[model samples]
Target chain A: MSSSEMTSPEETPLLEVRELSISFGGLQALNQVSFAVEEGEIFGLIGPNGAGKTTLFNCVSGLIQATSGVIHYEGQPLDGLPIHARSLVGIARTFQNLNLFHGLTVLENLMVPVEVRQRRGFIADAFRATRSRFGESQAREEAGAILHLLHLGDLRDVMAGELPVGLQRRVELGRAVAQRPRLLLLDEPASGLDGRETAELGALLPRIARQLSVTIVLVDHDMALVMRVCDRICALDFGQVIAMGTPAEVRNDPTVMSAYLGASGAVQVAQR
Target chain B: MRFDRQLLVRAAMVIGAFDVLYLLADHVGANYRRLMTLSAVDGLLVLSLVVLTGFVGQISFVQAELNGFGGLLAGAMIGRLHWSFWVALPLAVVASVAVGIVVGVPALRLRGLILGVVTIALALAFDAWVFSLDTFKAQFIDRPSLLGWDLSDDRATFAFCLAVLAGCAWMVANLQRSKTGRMLASIRDAEVAARTSGVDVTRAKLLAFGISAGLAGLAGVLLDLTIGTADKQSFTLLISLNIAAVVILMGPNRVASAFAGGIFLRWGSEILDKVGVGGKYLNVVLGVGLIVQLIAAPEGVVGQFSHIRAAAGRSLRRRVAAT
Candidate 1:
């Protein structure tokens, strides 16, 4: 329930991306980068464009086949599993670009995962009429609760695409969380959010991580929000890890400063 | 607001009236009833198109080929092997579903133009290589019969077709409401996103295609029985185009569009016949209709209605809030 309670070394790491590497034809996108996210902690993956932030997320979620590496998810090796199987194993992710079903309503979007889970009990849902009625009700209630949590309960009936970019991102996040996963991978969640929206996201991220008992792996460009929300940060440049430490340490790390602010930015980091 | 009991009653009345009219029309003129039966069979085939291309966003011209597969199998069993139509029907459906699964394995990895090209190739290959063979053609030489039921008449075949169409409609509706349906929808909307959400895109696509083909195959068996014959010309690539036309006209979400599309197919042929035109010109008309529908209503007829209803609901809500 609490962040500190989730940090025991003996307990399983929710996700462990070990020496993960990937390539696209002539270029290496990810190179022997390793990181571990503990339960209920907000872990941030930060880098500039082409630093393989999204690629890392893809590999972890099993969208991209790793060139060579192991992804241990909650003590189980996730390397062999496909993306959806990873989801069934309690891993859910939101895309960098909003991927909400534009034609579907927000509630329906949330219901997608629930319906998928219900499919395992398809015979029961179809034949066991009494139990199915209760199951359907419970699924709807959970979807509603998720919508409510994301402050989009009123928009449940509205088309997801009709919502503004900020709300759409929120809905995307909500759908991912609706799966009730142990780990949540968010790819550049702050991409389009304005300063105020970013600040709101900063405040909301930690609250959601705690509320849902989900370990958050946030990849974002908003350094301020990342610094504020993430318990630890991993900085990457050219597919390799530049720095890995607590937010304050990473913010002050000379290597991280150079990765973001260039060679001269190290002085500024030291000054800060 | 009152649960639209009047709408329900009106719908039931119309359906009942049509059924009675169909029965009477069968007695009055068997040919007219035969045409209605044809339309229902065509409607069932079109339902497959609507489900695969419309709902799941997998473009396969092989739907007609799948239908052909059914016809050929039914023909071979009943005509050459002297098997009953009852035995052939389920066998044909299963065979087509197997073929669909085979095609889907490779086809699922392809998208858009590539997918279209690949499936069209598959359809062409099926026509040229399999159907043209003497061994294959030899199987479809006799009249078909069901369990103690001769399908040589109009009324019996019409009832059978109607039942098939109803089953296809129910199955599609159930699928669309199921998790697999949502997964296919997600893949259609955004594959990458769906993949991240833990959806097996390959499996979803295969299932969609398999179900679509199975429905088409079932419809085809019914068609072969109704016509009392299986001809290569009837199961040509043009049938695929016609199926696509129906899907374009009716859209993806509504099963009723299948029937609407079938009626259009029948009317197009009839109007062409009356106007001294031929089946060749029907293609031209269908092509134009497809282009127009894509431009005017990419979501198809049902989509347009839903859009309008949604807009109306929004306006009504705004007005209520203002009050």
Candidate 2:
């Protein structure tokens, strides 16, 4: 048995990806990439555009099937599971492009995951029975709490699509958090945010990881936010992991520096 | 709960308006009363489209086909099997729902124009083969006798159909506020996002189709009873396209829109007839109306009205504050 397989239940990683690989028609998107996210840690995946960061996130969340790999969540194999099934098993994700439901209100957007996690049946919903009523009320309350946590309580009734892009990203974060998942995958949560908003998010991510006790795998191109927020960082270049270590170690790595800045340039790391 | 008062007022207004219409139909001639009844049945059919197309963002041209299936089944159960209306009604709805699930299973792999084509194919098949079956060719379908009072009376049947429409509207309104409804909207907005959030997109899609089919089935039975005949010609593919046009023209988000679409579907032709306009002219009007609405108000007539109302309210509040 592998060392990872021999880990006890209590010490098992929250998420383990082994030799994951996926290729498009003629181009390889990800190649034999592997990583393990510990519980309650803010892990970061940093790469330039087309480095397959989003693709890796998609594979972990089961939105895209890996060409070859084994993903174990909490020591159980997650092979062949559908996206919703993975979500039900406590895997929640936010899109790189904000995917908030445009037709629904902000509060209703947050309630989507809560509703999915609840136990209301179709018959109950059709009849407007007690179970359905109670479940909806509970979902609303939970969503309200999440909105408050994200400091978006005032915009609860606003249409999601009508919100600013920065606010939309926060709403998407709230939606993923509302799932109450053990593992959360956020794709480019700071992509479109201004510096102030990105800084706020940088502080918020670690606090969320600590307070909620949830593991987070964040993929973002924002170097400063990733360096400040993430405990460990994985830098990928052309679908290959170039560095995986503490944020400082990744920042100092020659390959990561060369990948970010061209080979001729001297590495000068910026301090946040 | 902030909108509770508004909701109550809207509900009261709707009920009062329908009550006034009921009284007006009572005083009017039988032809007018029959028109109103048919309009209510059409309202239910449009509501099915509202749920499927408006809320779930799925375009289906098979609603009329599902309606035909229900009408045929209800006719068989009542005319041949000697079943009561209550028994036959539920059976017909359930059967249509089953067929909806069957169609929805294959439809899961299809979306947008392809799905529309598949539904159109289903509609054509029903029109060509299913309706031509000897068993579905019932001369007359008997109406139910409720509480020893024959519902064959025009006024009573009108009231009954009105009540059914009201009940369906209320249920759909309630559904829009429910969790399932939110999930459906999410699926419509972003299927991948909804799936990542743990929503069973396939199940939600199937449920949307099922509810739509069941509602269509109810509308079919009511239409058959109102006309006092089971004519297959009444549910042609052209009728399906016409209903789609009406729903799109009038909007499908609100039950009021569906109700309005039904009225327009029935009375628009009547008005054209009264004006000595040919039936083909009515098609031109519908086609033009659909194109105009799509370009100017894609949210539909009722949705645009609400937007205007909200804007007006905001301006009024601003003026009051300024004063």
Candidate 3:
């Protein structure tokens, strides 16, 4: 896994979001939000409620099409690709609420993406035919590698729903990574976790980015996680880019402070 | 490829058990033998529901519609087109896939009870229009004596139907363990989540629907071959509802439960008829049994057995460890 893509940021950014905007009915959910994520970087999107952070993730992942503007992945336009097509093209995402299959074990959950990555037709797979069985051993090897990578080796055969929420979140992350995505979109992965779990997640993001050689764009409300892990952070407010820079620079910006802690209670944010 | 040893063993067991039962059936009458054949046909129908509602979680009340279409088409090919039954078999399955796709298209947009209601409507339309067509009906239905075996005899018909049902059952069992099986299971658990995981939800659901319908079609073709008729009236919405009830009673994931429900109900009805109760009144038995199953064991008889088997395996492992 190479981190060399981070050094050549001058080349076409791994993901370039240009003036993306969308509206649900009359309310403009996102308005001209723009940012570029270089490869092997843990980029964070932080904002208060209704700030269009999730909307932006949805647009980039192709869950919903943007009303205007464009998203370029590895210098290629992702305009016409469907949701699963985007995943096939090395884009993967997790939901705000965890979406792991309750019936399947953690190993099988990871195998879903491994099977998807193999791109074998279901008809052949139904009969256990040539092309389907060809990658069976390799897929298991890859799934084992991922289970180890995600620290889920212990819970390999445990049903995904039986695991703790923190572990389920980890399994969901492992599942997305199993797709071999170049750009991983994580939506509010820390919503239900306690301090310890969130800290562990904060620790995992950078390791995932560096080790897997994937660019990360996470939408989160946890400021400590945002400030601690992200190489650079983008702040959104009322569907627009409010701040875009290093964590220190963005933290010091007055507009971001007022947007989060309000103008009067600004200094209290440092304690939070 | 290595065959699943357990499945092969189970298939042999089912066949051996039925042969033993055939000895007792001979003392009773030819009616018992005929019911044995019906049991296998019913198993195919129940397996159809297993795929549609069980794996895909798509509620389809139009399974009988698809089944009737396949049966009649196969019959027509054998009778009207003067084609061999073996040749018409694949054509029937292909035609059922087309019908399944049509029924499944609405499923891409609809769900649950609404989908069921839509299928019910489609079922009536099919009986009144599609199945009523001269093209789908054949007056000259004949037994498929493909390998020079007379399939018309009671024992032979039961054996042949049982073999066909077992073959389909084996194929379906293999499917549920493969990647496509996981794909369908994932869709059942979480459709949106599956899409984000790079599973084309539409394709997975439709594929399930197609395979399920094909099974139903295959069963229907076998039914026409056995009984020498493919009357559309026999495939009413009532039969589909009965199948749905059995699907709920037997548990979805357990493939054997489909056959179990079929054989139990077929014999149950036969016994009921001999004991001065109308066999049609078994719907009362089904309803009561369903109520009991829902309250005591929602996973149904098969799921209950699965739990017991797992527990027994664990205890056996512990015993070996102690030694």
Candidate 4:
């Protein structure tokens, strides 16, 4: 067998977006964008502001419907599923701005997603059945484990809003991890972090991908961290893919250099 | 285990307070008993607000209308169909929940003040059209006699109303600590976050509405029992506004706070009536209280009490250190 076949014999891309387009009134937010993310790969989506990176993530997570085209996950069409259904089917995400539940504690924030996976109904909960308690304890244990893994064990009881931005981001990441998702979408995870915190996150992402065997799709403006961590990268300009390849190949591409600098400066950067 | 201990302490305090009130009513006279019974029913109604406005952060102005629907159904079932109180109560609650879902599903598209507007319109419609129907007239109710005891007896009815209030309070407490409650709270704080976390946002909101409406329906049955009639005036749009005002003034976080709100709403009005001010002035008092609550204690009276307790503890600790 070939080396590619040896790695993944049943090689089916985890996510495939085809000719997706969405317009807000007269302006096109995303214009016929398409890409495929393979299993267990740390795929990076990098672009300047207003390049429609978040808009694409929203479309993939089912937060907003695309005006046209199809999205396939695990080889099945994700046409009519709602946001929660998409999450249940192993697609979990975090927001660019910290969207942690302000009323809940760090532990409680993690438990919210875990509790949703429990089978106990509201009647069972209201009645305080043994099954409900068992489900609750299980969720708590899962949340605790994720907290420990993320080094947030000490801040378990801290209100999410009281935490600093770095810690809040960690809590959001821990929450998504607690869901035990097969695919995780993170929007600007390194946006508010200092250099040290960004480095820690850079190391943490690959470790998470390796240990959990989870594919990651990350959108961010941190080029240094993105180049170091992501196995493959896709760069966008004007809601269209300008370059898509391995990190080294994308970095060498003239279009990417021009997109970052300017059309005239691409040659100078490439020469250097 | 810590959670259980806290819950146990809260339960004991609530039951003990109710016991004291019950004994006091027994000695004071029928007038006091009548007031306490109304307060108990109001307690249930405020709890409906606790689930929706407090936990889910959905402002609704139609709780009284939902309460009226329950009373109307109870009157029809017990009076016309000759059904027992036990049979009519659950049926009324279920029917009210169905109506709540119908209203709640569409209201989900709107948020904050807009949703409040829709609910106000609904309350007006219920008062002007639904409650005025001939079938729901106050004369149609029939008080049930359960297990050799007639609920028509003032003392028996008071005790029965207290019992129902206790059950509802216990259930509300249980729901607050459960996963369902956490999910609802999450939605309240952040809807998009809750949705991305795998919570069915629509379903959670609908369930909150149903539970809120169900509690109001249960209160309606008790209200009808207390008065021995289904008085449309008691469940009017103005009454709904008053109930919402009370919840805002008393805090909606804990079940005990809802009970406290109910007592304050009922007895506060009685005090004004005794002073020759009458029930008409009660709304003016509530409006002033609501303003004070917003400015001084946005978390409401119960939350303010906790803050005071915390401050006192800190001061005591500082004094000990200084000495």
| Per-residue alpha-carbon lDDT of candidate 4 for residues A156-243, written as tens digits (9 for 90 to 100) | 9999999999999999999999889999999999989999999999999999999988999999877777788888888887788888
Chain A TM per prediction? 0.89, 0.92, 0.91, 0.92
TM-score of chain B of 2: 0.93
Model 4 docking tier (incorrect/acceptable/medium/high)? medium
Candidate 2, B147: how far from true, in Å?
Answer: 1.7
Sorted by DockQ (best first), the order is 4, 2, 3, 1
Where model 3 places Cα greater than 4 Å from the true spot, the runs are A1-10, A262-268, B1-28, B137-140, B274-277, B316-323
Lowest lDDT block of 10, candidate 2 chain A: A1-10
In terms of lDDT, the poorest run of 10 residues in model 1 chain A is A1-10
For model 1, state the Cα shift of residue A202 in Å. Answer: 2.0
- Put down candidate 3 lDDT per residue, A1-272, tens digits, no spaces: 00112335458988999889999999999998778898788898877789998888888888898999999998999998888888888999988888898788888888888887776776676677877777666777798899998788989889998998888898999999999999999999998889988988888888888888988998887777888888888888889888888878778787788787753324444675
Q: Clashing residue pairs, candidate 3? A: none
TM-scores of chain B, in order: 0.85, 0.93, 0.90, 0.91
What class would a CAPRI assessor give candidate 2's docking? medium
1 versus 3: better TM-score goes to: 3
lDDT of 2 by residue, A69-170 (tens): 888998899988998999898999898888999889999999989988888766777678889988999999999999998999999999999999999999
Better of 2 and 4 by TM-score: 2
List DockQ, one per candidate, in order. 0.45, 0.73, 0.65, 0.74
Model 2 TM-score is: 0.94
In Å, what is the interface RMSD of model 1? 2.9
